[model samples]
Target: MPLLILGLLVWSVPHLFKRLAPEMRAGLGDKFKGVVALLVVAGVVLMVIGYRGAEVVPLWYPPSWTMHLTDLLMLFAVALFGLGNSKSRLRGRLRHPMLLGVITWAVGHLLVNGDLASVVLFGGMLIWAVLSIFAINAREPEWERWQGGSVAGDIRLGVITVVVYAAIAGIHYWIGPSPFPM
Candidate 1:
């Protein structure tokens, strides 16, 4: 539990620091990016170790209905994730579509998996995404909508979203814990 909590903090704090402490990041200058990268790598390693060894305590069982919700939500999440880096008009409306996608994905997983490990991992991610969105908004108050996103780009994003989402689902199925109900 300690490791899990530590990993979550390690993963999120560096990201939060840039928004929360601009002066600190400025003081660090160019090295700040390198520090963040190291922290992320360390955090990922800690999370992998902690999650693998952590005791599995069963929480409430998710209903079968949640699986359906997961399918739909994951589709939306991936599309939103793509929108984050895309020049689509849809991206213009969202301040941080990637973080929002993370929140969506985390919430969907939390709903479907009620074990202690799942709760810690997914819940921590959800918290981090929400906090990051808020911190980013606070840091950048001005919003400028991107102008003239071509319809072709939007269509291309849809194709990419479907292909990527399918690949992710296939990988999940191949590895284990198939998201779909048999």
Candidate 2:
């Protein structure tokens, strides 16, 4: 749990830093760019390990039906993440697809895993998503118009998202403990 908390702090702080302290981020980018990259990688690795380790503790059991719902939500989250990186109509409509993705992911996990660690991890992410969105809106007063791109790009992004989601779902079933273990 301590490791999990540390990982969450590490993951959230760096992300929040960019939103809360843009000047500091810029200075660090200029001064300790390489160190920053190393730290970021280390933080992500820790977060992954912490999350996986924490999953061992079953704090609460969700009904079997909820797992299906979680899967669907995760798929949508992946699609949102994909749209975030593309010039799709969904991106323009969402305005903040990346943040939406984080929220969806966090919420989806929270519904299925009711353990203390899961709550802490997913709740922290949810808080970060909300705060980061607020910070971004506050920092950037001017609304930038969404980029217009070819429909082909949108199709490509959609296909990629579906493929990646399917791959992950398959991997989860094959190598990981059943996420919907009854």
RMSD of each: 1.4, 2.2
Candidate 1 lDDT tens digits, 1-182 = 77887898899899888889999789998967988999998988888778867898999899999999998999999999999888676878887889989989999998899899989998999999999888878878888766667788789889999999999999999977897999
| Candidate 2: tens digits of C-alpha lDDT, residues 71-175 | 888888899888877867656777678898989999988888878878888998899898889999999977776767668878888789889988877788888
Off by over 4 Å in 1: none
Alpha-carbon deviation at 50 in model 1, angstroms: 1.9
Ten-residue stretch with the least lDDT total in model 1? 144-153
The top-ranked prediction according to lDDT is 1
Q: Assess the local accuracy of residue 33 in candidate 2 as a C-alpha lDDT between 0 and 100.
A: 60
How much is the lDDT of residue 1 in candidate 2? 69
